[model samples]
Target: MIIDRIDRALDMTSAIVAGIDGGQYADASLCAGWTVRDELNHLVGGMRIFTARLTGTDPGGEHHDDWLGDEPANAFHLAAEADRAAWRRPDALEGVIELGFGAVPAPAAAAIHHTEVLVHGIDLALVTGQEKLVDDQECERLLGEMRAMDFSMFRNPGMFGPETAVADDAPGHRRLLAFLGRAV
Candidate 1:
């Protein structure tokens, strides 16, 4: 089930990138200072980091802030494929991996990446004026995962934003965005 979720997430990310035109890459994303391209970079780099951990290899980099500049589509597909391949390994879904922040069990790591891909996919869609690209089902599933996890570590500066108020009756996606500090 988790692997299927990851596959779906990657497919969504790939489709978003494929649909984006060249000129929109510089638009500001929901992430404070990051552009759409920067968000893509972070997504790809994150997958790279996860792949490294799962494969027990060095990432050969101190940071993952670089962007594709003019080649985002191809770069993203290649990186995404590598990431998916690594995670598809028979043993990749078991045991624990060090995530720089700490050691997390594979399931928790999958959940983290699943949330990242879906949320950032929304960010990319919103910034590009392609909000229809956001998947409602993914958002709902992510909302459930977020609500079930302890939010203690999510309040940090670069992580989740301060909790925003949402109406009790708001839609699942809106509530999820609110919880993540994105005004909805």
Candidate 2:
């Protein structure tokens, strides 16, 4: 089940990365002050950080931000390249990675990793004039997880009011973020 989730997540990331060349703005999302490019970079940069955690290293001072005053793609690209290099080390995934928030087991972190891919995949698609990549099955799994989570991580207050509801079997990424209160 987890493997399937990862497969879908990875596919989403791959498609978004490949489709984007950073030109479209009409279909751009309302990610606060962030442009589509900035949102893509933020999501990719956040991946770089989390990927480093999987490899037992500090990913500098990266953050999981929703807003970008002037976030740069080149900067995020450089950071992502460095993080990729770190993942090549022989003992990278040897120990339990300190993922800033907590020390989660390697296998269990698949869900988190899956979450990153699915959520950011949307960010990339929205920014780059691409279509949504998350399908129904993956969304259901992530939605279930989010509903059970405490939801202070990505749940921005402006987006989800108390009355807003997230369907358990809705689109994967949408339900995932909504469950976290980022249904924007």
Candidate 3:
């Protein structure tokens, strides 16, 4: 079930990445200090690391060096497909994996990947003037994940910025963004 969610999120992420053009890549993304291209690179790098984790291999080093290859969209597609393939392995969903923070069950790892892809997909859509690309179901799922997580887990620096203040009755997506320290 979580793997299904991860696949859905990856589909959305790939679509968003494919829609970006060269000129728009320089636009500021929702991620602080990151341009649209930088966010996409981060997504690619994350996919590589997660793929290695699922396959029981050391991720070794940052892949940012070649992040923006001749064709970024193609690179994203290949990376995402590899990541998906790794997760689809027979024993992939049956083990614990180190997520840098600690070792977590495979399902939890899938959930984390699902959240990252969905959140960053929205970021990519927003910056590319494709707000219509945002999926309400994906937003709702991520909002639920945020609601179910412990607040303390997000308090540390580099985990999230300080939680932003939002109206009590804000929509789930807006609230989720606020909770992640993003100004919506």
Instruction: List the RMSD of every prediction in angstroms.
Output: 2.0, 5.3, 2.2
Candidate 1 lDDT at 179 equals 86
Candidate 2 per-residue C-alpha lDDT over 12-101 given as tens digits, one digit per residue, 9 for 90 to 100: 666666665645532455355666565666666666676667665665556755322343444544544554455445654455655656
- Candidate 2 backbone collisions, by pair: 139-172
TM-score of each: 0.89, 0.60, 0.88
Q: Write the per-residue lDDT of candidate 1 for residues 1-184, one digit (tens) a residue.
A: 8878888888877888888889988888788888888888888788878888888887655446663545889878887898889878999779998886889999889888888877887778767776676677878888887789887578864588877898988766667788899876
The segments of candidate 1 whose C-alpha lies over 4 angstroms from its true place after superposition are 65-69, 156-158, 165-171
- Every candidate's lDDT: 0.80, 0.57, 0.80
Query: Which scores higher on TM-score, 1 or 3?
Result: 1
Model 1 steric clash pairs: none
lDDT of 1: 0.80
The CA-based lDDT of model 3 is what?
A: 0.80
